[model samples]
Structure formats: C-alpha cells, structure tokens
Target: MSVLMSAFATLVGGLADLLQPLFHAGSAAAAIILFTACVRLAVHPLSRAAARGQKARTKLAPQIAELRKKHGKDPERMQKALMELHAKENVSPLAGCLPSLAQIPAFFLMYHLFSSREIGGEPNELLGHSLFAAPLGHRWADALTGDGVFTGAGLVYVALFAIVAAVATFSFRMTKRQMAAAPTPAAPEGPDGRPLPGMGAMAKVMPLMSFGTLLTVAVVPLAAGLYMVTSTTWAAVERYFLYREMWAAGAAPKASGAARGAGGAEAA
Candidate 1:
C-alpha cells in the first residue's frame, strides 16, 4: 500500500511539474484535474459499453414486462426468467454502474494523498501546494475558520460551489428529460394498477440526487474536490450525448411506422 501511495504521489508530482509553467502555484490543483481526465479517458470504453447496454435494456423493456406479468406470482421464477433473458440477450443489467464504480479508487487516492502528512516515511510535499490562496490539503471548514468566507481561500470554495451547483443543475435537467422521454414500463399492475410500492417515490427523488455532489465537494479536501468537479462535469456532458443517441435510435422505428401509415392512407 505504501509503495502504491508512493507511486501515485510521484505521478501527481510529475504532472505538477509539467503544469508548473502555466499554473504556477496552482499547478498541483491543475495536475489533479489532468489526472482526473486521464482516469475518465481510461474508462471511456467502459462508458461506451455501458451506454450500449442501457440501449439494449431499453429495447428489452417490453419483453421484461411480459415476463413480469407471466411470473408475477412466483418471485423465484421471475428471478430465474429475468436472468435467462439477460443471458440470452448478452446484456449485463449492472453495466451502467461500471464507469462510476471504476472512478472510486482514483477519488480515494486523491483524498488520501492530500489528507496524509507523510508518504512512504517522508514529508508529503504536495500538502504545501495551493490553488491560489486555498491549500490543496485543506477543507472548506478550515478556510472558513482561518480566514473567513470573503477571503481568498473561502472565495475559492465559493467558486467551486458555484461550478458544482451549475453542473448539478445540468445533470438534474438531463435526468428529468431522460425519465420523461423513457417508455413507461408496462409494470405488472397491483390491484389498483399503480406502480409498485416506493417505486414512484424513488423516481421523484432520484433526479434531485445530482445536487448531492455539492455537499460532497464542500466536505472533501480541495484536491479531491477538484477531481469531483472535473468528473461530475465530464459525466454530465457524456450522459447528454449518450442519451441523445439512445433517444434517436429509439425513435427511428416509430418514425418509419408513421411514414408507412401515411403511405397506406394515400394509396387507399
């Protein structure tokens, strides 16, 4: 573990060195952002695969609904049938989670790298780095207590909060749009033909979860907050394009059907 930490420290130091000319005192912070980009780039293929999986699952929703109706009374049978269907279709239901899960290690590394005072038995020099007046190793609370909110470090936090809020808003809207555009699952109706218990509430709450990143950015070390900001922004943009592609793909057949109906009417 110490060896791994040492290597990661070296990587960050190397990136800081490369960025020093441009970023000056904030080079370490810039290096964190660049490291984040590299991490996201490495996981891009998984993200694409996840997108394809999501499209496949969307296409399979109707069949899944049918299975749900057929096996609604038998929980075990339903589970077995769902597994079989996914296997036959070569789709992993959990694929959408890969890109997010893959990033956890990188985030934790940044958090620990900045939080620690020593690395491999030596003083951690990276702690001395700052993004303007904000120390990369410091938290928002530290800045607030030491210099107050209007001071340089506090203003840095303010800027970060603003950016996070904007990104979260973008993500929230995108999520709502996707949910609105998605085909309603022909869920197995309960006695009242309503969605399953808690499902509706969950749907309503999920979109707002995007704003949770604000709380995250506020609490973590500045270095990790930088990573979070970069990553969250990347995710919002990537999701927009991927969801747009999926929407277009899903609409093509409906468009063709409409054209066919119009042609039939003209012939008649």
Candidate 2:
C-alpha cells in the first residue's frame, strides 16, 4: 500500500511541478484536476465498452421481458433463459459496471494521496499547498470549526461546496433522464399490473445519489473534493457524448435469432 501510494503521489507531485508556472503555488489543485482528467481519459475505452453494453441491453429489453413472461414461474429457468439471451446478444450483465469498477482502486488512491499527512514515508509537502485560500490538506470540517464559517478560508470551502452541488444537480438530472428512458425490469408485478413494490421507490431514490456525493465533498480534503467535482462532471459530459455518438451510429445490439424465436414461440 505504501509503495503504491508513493508512486501515485509522485505522479501528482510531478504534474503539480509541471503546472507550477501557470498556477504558482495553487498548481497542486490544478494538478489534481489534470491528473483526474488523465485517469478519466485512460479509462475511456472501458467507459465506451460499458456504454455500448448498456445501450445493447436497452435495445434487447423487450426480448428479455418476453423471456421473463415465458419463464416467470421458475426462477432457475428464468435465470438460464436470461443468460442464454445475453450470450446470443454478446452482452454481459456487468458490462455497464466495468468503467466504474475499474476506477475504484485509483479513486481510493487519490483520496488517500491527498488525505494523508505522509507519503513515501516522509512528511507530505503536497498537503502544505492551497487552492485559492483553502489549503489542499484542509477538510471542510476543519475550515469551518477552526477558521469560523465567514472567514476567507471557510468561504473558500463554501465555494467548493457550491461547485460540487451544481455538478451534482446536473448529474442528477442526466441520471433521471436515463432512468426514465430505461425499460422497466421484467420482475413480478403487483396489483393493477404495477411494478412490484420497491421498484418505483428505488427509481425515486437513485437520483438522490447526487446529494450523497455532496455529503462526501463536505468532509473530504479539498484536493479530494476537487477530484470528485472534476471526475463526476467529466463523467456526466463524457457519457452524454458517448451515448449520442453510439446511438447516432446505431451501434446497439439487435436481438439474435434464438432470442427472437423464443419470444415468438411464447407469443404464439
């Protein structure tokens, strides 16, 4: 863990050194943003794959619904049919999760890289840096409690909070739009053909994840907060462009013959 964090901090410090001319001492914050952008770009191929997979699943949702209708009574058979359908379409249930899963390690590394007082077994000088008036190493809690809420440093934290909130709002809207477009899962139905209990509730709650993100920003070191804001904002915009490009080009997978045959047989 120490070796990996040492390497990670080295990379960030190197980037900070590179950008020092432009930002002066504030370059540490800018470096975190740039490093995050590089990470985002590096993981983009996985993001593209995940996007393609999600779009394919959306395209195949109807056939999946049919399979569920046919095999609804037997959980084992339904699972088997679902797997067969996915195999035919060349999709994985986990495809949409690939980029996110891939990013977890790096994300935690950045968090620790900024949050720690030591790196490479030495006192971390990077923490001495500040962005605007806010110290990169200072948590929002520290700024509020120590500096008082109206002080310059405390206000800097507030401004960061605001930026994060705005990004979170935009993210929430985009997520809600996508969820609205998603075909409802082919699960057991409740009265009046309604979706089963908790489905609607789950949909409503998912958008609030953005607020959860805001909560994270409120406690983390300013450097990590900067990372969160930059990465999430990048993710929202990246997903938008990728989804449009893939959809405009008609890249979503079409149902294979086996899936169509199964659905047709059930229909008849």
Candidate 3:
C-alpha cells in the first residue's frame, strides 16, 4: 500500500512537472478534466470486472449458501468447492474488489497533484496565477506549506468546494446503494465461498468516512479539488449505472416471481 501510494505521489510530481505550461493557456479545468478522463478510462475495465463478480455472487447466492452450510468450518474444502463452482459458472469471485483497489492509486495521485505547490522551476500557477489570486475554479487546494499541508481559504473557494463536496458525497451514497441493491445481505460469502459477515458491516462505517473526507475538501485549491471530486462523482455515476445493469441481470427471474415460486423453487 505504501509503495503504491508513493508511486501515485510520484505520478503527481511528474504530471505537475510537464503540464505546467498548460496553466499559462488558462486550461487548468481542461487539463484536470482530461487527466481525470484518462484515469477513469484506465480503471473502467477493472470496474466492469468487479461488477461481473458482484453479479456472479448474486446469481449463485443459493448455491453459495448451501456450500457454506456443508463446509462452513473447513477452509480448504470451502475454497476448493468455490473454485469448482466459479469455474462451472465462469465467475470470478474477487471481481468486485478490483475497482476499489484500482481507485486507490488514482485517489492518491489526485491528492499529490492537488497538494503540489510548484510547477517546474516557477511558483505554481494553478489557473495561471498566485494561490489566492487564482480564480476559484483553479485553486483546488490552498497554498500548501513545504510539508504539503493546505493553509488558507476564501469565500469563492469555499463555495466551489461545497459544490464538489456535495456531488462527491451524493454520488458515493447512491452508487454503493445501487451496488448492494436490496438491503445488504448478511453473512455474504467471501471469494473462497466461506461465509463471513456481509458487506453490511462495512457499509455502516464507510459512509461516515466518506462524508467526513468530503467535508474536508474546503482546504484545497478550487481547481485541484474539483478535479478530484468531479472525477469521483463521475466515476460513481458511471459505476452505479453499471451496477444497476448487473442488478437487473441478477434479479431478472425475480421480476417474474419465478425466483420465488414453489413449483420451481428448487430450479430457481
């Protein structure tokens, strides 16, 4: 984790190094949007895979439960059974974990980019000027100390920060809800098909961390901050739609009550 974090920080350092020239062209917003687009595109495949894994789990929920009922205490047997089952169904149990893991690198990259204070040998010109003098659209984070801590704020900066904050927060809540679909299942099976406390356990904690972090965006330069929040919000929107489709696929038979009928309950 530390190595990946540092590598992303290094990415921030590199992007800040080369793209400083675009600041002069008054395209900081464009630059930010472009960078974010590239990052999202890079992670899209993993996101789709995770969605696939999630759908697979939903599709095979009954078999997963039966397997656990039979071998809940034997880790080895559980893993073998899961592998066999997944192979038969062509599903990757860990698929849902991919998108989250992929985002860590991009999240930290944005943090480094936003925390950066200088571009090239020149003082940073986020939207083409000094920190306080830069437009609200440009100053995403306040001017950071050499130690990389944000230092100040203004009315314009605060207002814009709030906008991004709201978008990031709402999108996150909506996406997670869409992914888990119905109330989160308790004791969700893990990748090895072993029964474990379900995602509901973490769901209770993540929202607090998410909202708390979103609230802190007011400390950054406006442009850098918006890039982070906006990209994340866009990713959430994209992910939710993806999950919605996955949900539809998994719950298809249920829509016709076939999933619940006694006549074919065993088949369902």
Candidate 4:
C-alpha cells in the first residue's frame, strides 16, 4: 500500500510539476484544462466499457422489467438469473460504470499533479512553464481553481459553478435525457438487464460532484480555470453523446475528443 501510495504520489507530483509550466500563458486554468484533457484522452478503455454498458443496458431494459415482474421478491433467483443473463451476454454487469469509474484515478492524479510542491525542480509531467506565474497553492485550489470564480466574472461563470454543483442533480438529467434521446443499436442482455450502473440516486449527486470539481478548477490559475470551464462544458456535452460513436468501436475507442472530451475524459 505504501508503495502504491508513493507511486500514486509520484504520478501526481510529476503531473503538477511537469505541467506547471503550461500555466505561463493564458492561465494555470489552461494548463489544468490541458492536463485534464490529456488524462481524459488516456482513459479510452473505461469509456469503451461504459459505452458498452450503456448499449447493453438499453438493450436489456425490457428484460429487466420482466425480471422485476417475475422475480422482484425472489432475491436469490433474481441474482442467479441476472448473473446467468450477464454471463451469456458477455456483459460486465458493472460495465456502465466505465465512464464514471474511469474518472476517479484521473481525479486523484489531477489532485496529485495540481498540488505537488517542487519535486526535483523539474516541470514534472506538465508541458509548459508559467507565463504569468500563478504559483501553485493548496490542493483545494486545484479543486476549486484556487478561488478563480469571483462574483463578477460573468453570469456564465457564476452559473457554471452553480450548474457544476447542481450537475449531480440537474445536468446529469439533461445528459441522461440526451443519451436517451439519441437512439442506439440493439445489444444483448440478461433477463434482469437494465442499464449497467444505473443512474438512480447517483444522478442527483452528480451535479453536486460536478460543482465541486469545477469549484476545484476555479480556484487555480485563470488558465486552469478557463480550461476547467471549457472542459466542463465539453465533458457534459460528450458524456451525453460520446456513447454512440464509442459503441461503434469495439473494446477500445479512438482518441478523438472535444476539449472536455480530453479533459473530462479522465473524470469518466
């Protein structure tokens, strides 16, 4: 555990130190966005898994409904049936978690990279040096952009932070709605198949999480914050839409991504 933790720390410190330079121009917000994007881009496997889960879920909805009707009270049989169905279909059962689950590590890495102090005096994993020099601060700064969102930025930034907070509650609803709005190809399913990683209560909490994430980005350098803003908007868009394209690809989706696609990709 210590080694893993140390390695994790290294990954993070390396990211922050490396990318710290990119904050020179635009703002650390920009670098943050870049870092977010780079991380997101690398998480294609999780994205693929999530899309697969989504496809499988849409395909399995009817079966799930039937299972609920037939075995709603028989927990053991329901479990057995569900497992059998999933096994037959080659489903991961938890596959819909691809996008969301993928993001945890990236978030940790971001925190690590964003918060690390001068490790080796080398620019860690970050790409460029600071243009205006927004010296790094606390980890919370990374989470909220180091207090970047002042009241006067715009109704947009103001609204964005609120939206990010409410994203768990509201934005994801729109996302899910959009996802449902777009038709997908059929998939095989288990008898009790529903969307893998159903977004029930989680839906309500996501916007809060989104808000927290954006807030984290807001406190950092303007560049990082700006990147956060752009990436957040982009991510919300992609989360709603990317499934269609990724589903077409087999196990690993290509790296094509929007700003948030790359940035938010890791947050998947």
Candidate 5:
C-alpha cells in the first residue's frame, strides 16, 4: 500500500511540474484536475458500455413488467426471473455503476495523499500546495475557522461551493429529465396500480442525490474536492450526450413500427 501511495505521489508531482508554468503557485491543484481528467478518460469505455447496457434495459422494460406481473405474489421467484432475463439478454443489472465504482480508488488515493503529513517515511511536500489561497491539505472547516468566509481561504471555499451548487443543479435536472423520459419499470405497484409503499418516496429523493456532493466537497481535503468537482461535472456532461444518443436511437425503431402499423391498417 505504501508503495502504491509513493507511486501516485510521484505521478501527481510530475503533473504539477508540467503544469507549473501555466498555474504557478496553484500548479499542484491544477495537476489534480488534469489527473482526474485522465482517470475519467481511461474509464470512458466502461461508461460507453454502461450507456449501451442502460439502453438495453430500457428496451427490455415491457418484458420485465410482464415478469413482475407474472410473479408478483412470489418475490424470490420474481427476482430469479428478472436475473434470468437480464442474463439471457446479455445486459448487466449493475452496468450503469461501472464508471462511478471505477473512480473510487483514484478519489481515495487523492484524499489520502493530501491528508497524510508523511509518505513512505518522508515529509509529504504536496501538502504544502494551495489552490489560490486555499491549502490543498485543508478542509472547509479549517478555512471557516481561520478567515470566516469572506477573506482569502474562505473566499476560495465560497467559490468552490458556488461551482458545486451550479453543477449539482445541472445534474439534478438532467437526471430528473431522464427519469421522466425513461422511467424504470422496477417500481413496485400495489393492486390498485399505486406505487407500493415507499417506492414513490424513493423516486422523489433519488434526483437530489447529486447535491450530496456538496457535503463531500466540504469535508474532504481540497485536493479531493477538486477531483469531486471535475468528476461530477464530467459525469453530468457525459450523461447528457449519452442519453441524447440513446433517445435518438430509440426513436428510429418506434417511428418504423408506427409506419408499419399505418401500412397494415390501410391494406386492411
């Protein structure tokens, strides 16, 4: 583990050196952002695969709904049928999670790198870096206690908060729009066709999950906060484009089906 930490520290230091000319004192902070972008790029293929899997699931909704209806009285049977269907269709139930899960290690590395005072028995020089007036090793609480939110480090945190809010809002809207357009068929329904028990409440709360990043950025070291912001922003933009492509692709089939139905009606 120490070996890996040492290597990651080396990578970030190299990036900081490369960015020093452009970012000056904040080069290390800039390096964190660049490193995050590289990580995202590496996991992009998994993201694309996840997108395809989501499209497949959307297409399978009707079949899944039928399975649910057929086995509604037996929860275990319904689950087994659902699993079988996904396997038969070559779609993974957890595919959408791949990109996010793949990023956890990188974020953890950044957090520990900045949080540590020593790395491999030597002083950790990266902790001395700052993003503008904010120390990369410091948290928002430290900024608050020192400068009280209107000066220097506090102002840097305020800026970070504002950017996070804007990005989170955008992500929230995008997710809500996607949910409306292609809702999951997995929401259990009671006999009267109402959403069963807590399902409706769960649906309502899911979109707001994006804003949870604000709390994360507030508590973690600034270096990790930078990673969170860059990653969340990238995810929002990537989801928008990918879902748009899915919608376009889905539309073509529906249009052809409609045309075929009209032709049959005229012939009849």
Candidate 6:
C-alpha cells in the first residue's frame, strides 16, 4: 500500500511540476485536474463497458418487468426468473457498477495524496501550492473560519462549491430523464390495496444520492475537490455523447422502416 501511494504521489508530483510554470499559484489545482482527467481517460474502457451494460438493462427492462409481474407472488421464483432473464439478455445487475467500482482505487489514491502531510517519506510540497490564496491542502471549513476568509481563498472555495452544485443539478436532471424513460414494473399491492414500493420512484430517488458530493467536497482538501469537479464534469459530457450515439444508432432501423412504409403509401 505504501509503495503504491508513493508511486502515485510521485506521478502526480511530476505532473504538477510540469504544470507549475503554467499557472500563477494554482498550479497544484491545475495539476489535480489534469491528473484526474488522465486517470479518467485511462479508465474509459470501463466506462464504455458500464454504459453498454446500462444500455442492455434498459433494453431488457420490459421483459424483466414481465417476469416480475408473472412471479410477483413467489419471491424465490421471481429471483430465479429474473436471473434467467438477465442471463438470456447477457446483462448483469452489476453492470452499471464497474465504472464506479473501477474508480475506487484512484479515488483512494487521491484521498491519501491530499490527506497525507508527507509523500514518499519526504516533505510534501504539493500542499504549498494554492488556488488563488487558498492552499490546496486546506479544508473549506478551516479556510472559512481562519484569516483566509478575508482573502481570495475564500472565494476560491465558494467557486468550487458552485461548480459542485452545477454538477449535482446536471446529475439530478440526467437521472430524472433516465427514470422517466425507463419502463416501470407492474407494482405489487399491499393489504390496504395501495401499491407497494414503485420501482420508478426508487429510480428517481437514486439520483438524489449525488447531493452527497457537496458535503464530501466541503471537508476534503481543495485539491481533491478540484479533482471531483473535473472528473464529474467530464463524466457528464462523456455520457451525453455516448447516449447520443446510442440513441441515433438505435433509431436508425426504425427510421428506415418508417421511410420505406411512407414510400409504399405514396406509391399506392
């Protein structure tokens, strides 16, 4: 673990050194963004795989729901049937998890890099870098309460928080769109005749989980916050392009068939 941390810190430090001359005092902050972007790009294949899994599940949703409705009374049967359906579709419930799961190690490396006062058993100089007047290693809360509150560092944190808020908003809207487009399962009824937990509602609520990022950014080193901002923004844009391609590709067949039908009608 120590060896890995040392190696990662060295890599990040080297990257920062290269970037240091480009920025005024925010070179570390810029370095964090660059480093994060590089890591995210390296994991692009995992993101693509995860996106494919999500697309598969979305396409198979109707059939899965039918299985659920058919076996609603028997939990064990429903589970087995769902498993069979997934197998047939070549989709795994864990498909959407791969991209995120793959990121855990990178996240830990960033966390340790920011949290540790020393890296590779030497004096850590990254902390000496700042975004504006705020040190990259300084926490938002510490900056707000200390003399930094009166300086440009305070504004830096405020700007970061704003970016996080924007990301959360975009995330919520994307999730809501996904939930709206997803096929809803036939919900079971309770004894009172009220419908039980609706899958649609659960899906919509899941996006709210993103708000936690704001809280996380508030307490971490500013460098990590910068990392989160750049990484998440990149993810949002990447998903947009990927989904656009998927939608266009999926629509092509239907579009061609519709065009042929119209031509036939015109001929007739």
Index of the highest-TM-score prediction: 1
List runs of model 4 lying over 4 Å from the truth.
1-32, 120-134, 138-170, 176-209, 218-231, 243-268
Task: Give the candidates in order of TM-score, highest first.
Answer: 1, 5, 2, 6, 3, 4
Candidate 3 overall Cα lDDT vs. reference? 0.59
C-alpha lDDT values of all predictions: 0.87, 0.78, 0.59, 0.52, 0.87, 0.74
Model 3, runs deviating above 4 Å: 1-26, 113-153, 172-176, 179-184, 191-200, 207-209, 219-224, 246-268
- Model 5 clash tally, residue pairs: 0
Residue range 1-268, candidate 3, lDDT tens digits: 4455455445544564566576643344445556677877888888877777666767777787788789888878988998899999989867777766776666555555445554343444443423334453333343332213333435545455566667667766665555456333554556566446656566556544556445545555455565666666666677767777765654674666764586586776
Name the better of 2 and 3 by TM-score: 2
**Model 2: lowest-lDDT 10 consecutive positions:** 185-194
* Candidate 5 structure quality by residue, lDDT tens digits, 1-268: 8999999999999999999999999999999999999999999999989988988978887887787678877877777787788889999867888999999999999999999999999999999899988999999999999988999899998888998999999988877766655646436444333347888777788899999999999999999999999999888888888888665665676789999999999999
Superposed model 6: Cα runs more than 4 Å off: 148-150, 186-204, 245-268
lDDT of 4 by residue, 1-268 (tens): 3354456546534555565576434344444555667766776567666667667756765676677678877767877877877777777767666656666665554444444443345444332333233333332333334445352333335654565665445455655453443343233333343333545555445435655667565555433444455556656666656654534432232334355587887888
- Point out the higher-scoring one by TM-score: 2 or 4: 2
Looking at candidate 3, what is the lDDT of residue 268? 64
Worst 10 residues of 6 by lDDT: 185-194
TM-score versus the correct structure, for each prediction: 0.87, 0.83, 0.65, 0.54, 0.85, 0.80
**Residue pair clashes in candidate 5:** none
Candidate 2 structure quality by residue, lDDT tens digits, 101-191:
8777877887898788888779998988898778888888888778777796888877767887887787787676566555655343332
Q: Give one digit per residue, the lDDT tens place, for model 1 in 97-213.
A: 899999999999999999999999999999999999999999999999988898989999999999999999999988876665566552322322235777777778989999999
RMSD of each: 4.6, 8.0, 7.2, 12.2, 5.2, 5.8
